[model samples]
Target: MDSSKELIKTVDLLLEISSLLMVSGANTNRVNLSIDRFASALHCNTSCFISHKTIVMTVYEDNSTLSCTRVKNIPPYAINFSIISAISKASWTAVEEDWNIDQIAKEIEAIKKQKRYPKLVVLIAVSLAGAGFCNIFSGDYINMGVAFASTFIGLLIFQLTHREGYNVYLRIFSASLIASVLASLGIVFKLGANPETALATSILFLVPGVALINSFTDFLDNNIINGLVRYTTGLMTVLAIALGLFIAMLLFQ
Candidate 1:
């Protein structure tokens, strides 16, 4: 294979890696570092830049040599730590050992397809987390149980809508609306000692806490634009949840 062509292929591969890392919830510095590290392993010079909706990467052997650039538009993806960790580890090893790109790509593909947790387990865990929120707020046992059940159903609705590829805001709004409305059932029927407790805790699953944390982390890392973008996105998510809750409250009131 010609040197230029092989280098271009490596550039394309790095582009894929960057997109995967970005969607998997890696911060800006980590994505750029991984791409540069992987490309350097293959003896190619690399530069990667990230923006709100786009990623651009370039590779060159020297200033005089033919350079290749790839640009990608990425939609947001759910955070999956298993995929992120797998790629980070693979990139580090590739940098250390200069591993074959094909093998690395295969590994990434396998990791991408793997599921770290069963859906049932995730539903149960999310339910427990919501119930935990009730406990944190000093709710009674009846309220905690209502939170548990409401969150379980809300998460189930979210999973279904998410799989259907609805718009992000719509998915969040629908999920919160369903959860809060159902949670209000405890209030209406007097099933729980505190109806307010169920409504409050049910929306815990929809909080944008992780996104806000990432936004602040990016700001600390000096990626101002990305930081602001993430913060704005998190804020919008919170608004969507609030709108959903407002609608539910109106209905149940």
Candidate 2:
């Protein structure tokens, strides 16, 4: 009974560590360090650590050790689920001496094999377009439609690049460029009513408002490094959009 209780406590510790690592966006090496620290904090002789640049975790216990390596590149959501499963298995092992880690791992494998979230990109695109439309000044249907279309195209570009696994920087650049070009075309050709207002609203989707907010939140949380990084990234995103628009105007003239 005491052994079972200890197992449950260890599992709880694992869950806490996993949650912290996930929130911090720690890489595999850092995750391992976190696990080690957590084990020390819990006064547990058992330790779990990950390999550098790999998703493999080596868990050392009193008399035995085990290694669990993810075979494929798992998404963040899947990783979260895996962490939960690991915690559950650890809890179960507390009550059962013959608990099969391999079987538990297989269960995690099965869960991962399930279809991932489809239409996530599509949803994000729709959200961007909607945001752009909302930012527009006019209430007329035609102006709104134009603004929505322009932003939709920009979002579509971002989604396409995202599907190809492009980095965040590239994705931001591509989205900004597309939005600027579309808005510029609308303005230069007089394609829509109140083109200036429409274009301004449409390009608002590419703004870094969320990033700035998060940066401030990070600062409030005393994460200076992360706050600065997020703030800089947000600034860069805004600048990229502005630069794209500027270039488009110069060429359109």
Query: Each candidate: what lDDT?
Result: 0.85, 0.55
RMSD for all candidates, in order, please.
Answer: 1.8, 8.1
Model 2 segments more than 4 A misplaced: 1-117, 120-136
Summing lDDT over every window of 10 consecutive residues in candidate 1, give the lowest-scoring window. Answer: 57-66
lDDT of 1 by residue, 1-253 (tens): 4877777788778888888887878888888888777877777788778976898888888655688888888777678778788888888888887788787777778877887689999999999999999888888888989899889988898899888988988888988998999888888898756779889889989898767888898999999999999999999899999999999999989
lDDT of 2 by residue, 148-214 (tens): 7777787778768877987766677777667767766766777655766656676676677655875
Best by TM-score: 1
Which is the leading candidate under lDDT?
1
lDDT of 1: 0.85
lDDT of 2: 0.55
